[model samples]
Target: MGATGTMNDAWLTLREVRAGDRVAVLSPSWAAPAHYPQVHEQAMDRLRERLGLEPVEFPTTRRTTTPRERAADVNAAFADPSIRAILSTIGGDDQITMTPYLDARPVRADPKPFLGFSDNTNLLSWLAYHRVPAVHGGSTQISIGPGPAPHPLHLDSLRLALSGGDHVLEVPTQISEVGHRWDHPRALTDRPESYPAEPWSWAGPSRAVTGRLWGGCLEILSWVLAVGRFVRPVEEYQGGVLLLETSEELPSPHEVYRMLRLLGERGLLAAFDALVWGRPIVDDERMVPDPVVASRARAAYREQVLRAVAEYHEDMVVVQDVDCGHTLPQHLLPFGEQITVDGVNQRVTAHFRRAPRP
Candidate 1:
């Protein structure tokens, strides 16, 4: 379906974020990575300096164990009429713990752009349950990291998420191929060797298929599944564009396949019309042993996804490496916005029919 109603699938007509918007920042679930503090400060600076939006930070922005406290902050942010949006500094591990405490009534009454990736999947999936569409990418720390500013893809998606549009985001032609030790003493200046960008590949038809974009960090989703907190659960996701990426934790290929198999078991894999797999974030310190282990990871993922589709979904199309999550130059995805995937033509485009930029 292209689009049926203004508030129906994808909800194309609403502008979730605006210029001069006041956003409250909170630590939705897990604590930020070691470099997170610097990343957070700099990212907020960019939003104010470049985007001209005001960011409000809650006391739990750095707290992970305090799920209730974090949930309270979210409640405050959503209930505050002055704050137009709520942005997670970045994703954490156990945000699903906050779901029981969230007052979904106020959120549904006035939905705003809630952005984050990785562990923040908790909020995105939770909001989706309440019919509050969230923008699935862009975190104050990761998206606006200390690199050369918002990596182009990072900026493009964030702008689109905050502003909305019909546009193409360029993948990183040159990529940060390695990871840094954030908690280590010498993280500020230690940069990794750069890797050249390869064009994105596809495994589906060239014609475009529009659907409300869904899915998030794969591990996060697994956790959400473990906690039984999907929006409407597996069946509600039929005909959606499913996007997934792995974190720096570097779960093994076996672990990845196991998770996919579990989703397959849940009848989730067969539900989506299309699948977009992000380039797994490969980190050295994670002791993954293989710097370019992405190849193995890709092979394993393909096998699992294909198995799930073969068993459950035959017509399902797949797209790999569209560049979202854990990777540098992260792109913002509309959690419930309509997106058109042009796989066969060797291009993937996301179109938005939102209000004009502020």
Candidate 2:
């Protein structure tokens, strides 16, 4: 199950951050901060107060800019010795365009934890290709700004990501698919409405599987695979753990199936020993307001996922509806670190390693 001459051959651990260290908060994709300055400011405050880290912004951090400009900012953050970590303001649809402009030298020379999700998968995958381990979730806008405070689980995992330690992923009792619009005043002070989360559904043998992590938002990953620049050979993923989640854009169940089917066709799906499917955001109060319809949609998503898994790798351990991805109370999974999926006890333990000084 070892890979050679591929991204998995040598994974670099990121240097952990300390309190009062400077962290670059950039807009590598959409400048959500530009449109919602108040929310962004609130998120900055929380970053300092909760994590004790000073937030620093680059030129494009709060403004819409070209992909090249965004990539320049990211490069600058990585090149700077004072910046211990980097966080994206939010994710957007066009981060894939930033790939060509990104300078891998800076990231490889000084690997610091880069935390983000959704379209930031573009950056995460690029970092992974260069052997730098990153974090898969932790958008400042969605994770820290909108809620009354950062969700405890999110904050805890984020803290561990920045520092260093082992964390057992917890299944949240309640989850929210939608939050108040940043334009709404209550978005600043109130927690989003939530409902009881469905218990995680497990499929496969009652055995434990441990491996390095790969994968991200399913739609963005499809784009990554199509682009074919950041992805490695399918064999590179053998015995690795695959993480998949959908966004609020809500691709249909058939689309989900097609994506997995494409992966299967590419020999990607069967390469992993286990898969962790994040809980999908099925209900949008303003869109699909009917709870019954939302429930059915959720079930259909699970069915399609299992359908694909069975087709590709029947013995692969799968645990769906875990609190990750588009849902609130998300857990920031380490993108290239070792994680254990114990199907017998149904627990996920993430092993976060502290980087050795270069």
What is candidate 2's lDDT per residue for 1-358, written digit by digit as tens? 1236643577777888999999999999999999999899999999999899999999999999999999999999999999999999899999999999988888888889999999998998888877889998899998898868998899999999888899899989877887889988988998988777778889998999998888999999999999998888788788999999999888999999999999999988899999999989876555224667667888999999999998999999999887779888899888988888899999998887877553
**TM-score of every model versus the real structure:** 0.86, 0.96
Per lDDT, the best of the predicted structures is 2
Compared with the true structure, model 2 gives a TM-score of 0.96
Judged by whole-model lDDT over C-alpha atoms, candidate 1 comes out at 0.69
Q: lDDT tens digits, residues 1-358, model 1?
A: 2212322444324455777888887778665733357656766788888878898987777655577888899998888878877887777667787888989777766667788888888888777766567887777765564554566667777777776677665677665534455454333344444565545656644556677777788888888788775546565677778888788787866787788778778887777788877876655454233535655555666666566666766676777666776766566777877776776665666765455544
The local distance difference test score of model 2 is: 0.88
| Cα lDDT, all candidates | 0.69, 0.88
RMSD of 2: 2.1
At residue 147, candidate 2 shows an lDDT of: 64
Candidate 2 runs further than 4 Å off: 1-8, 286-291, 356-358
Prediction-by-prediction clash tally: 3, 0
- Model 1 bad stretches (over 4 Å): 1-16, 33-36, 63-65, 177-179, 183-192, 286-293, 353-358
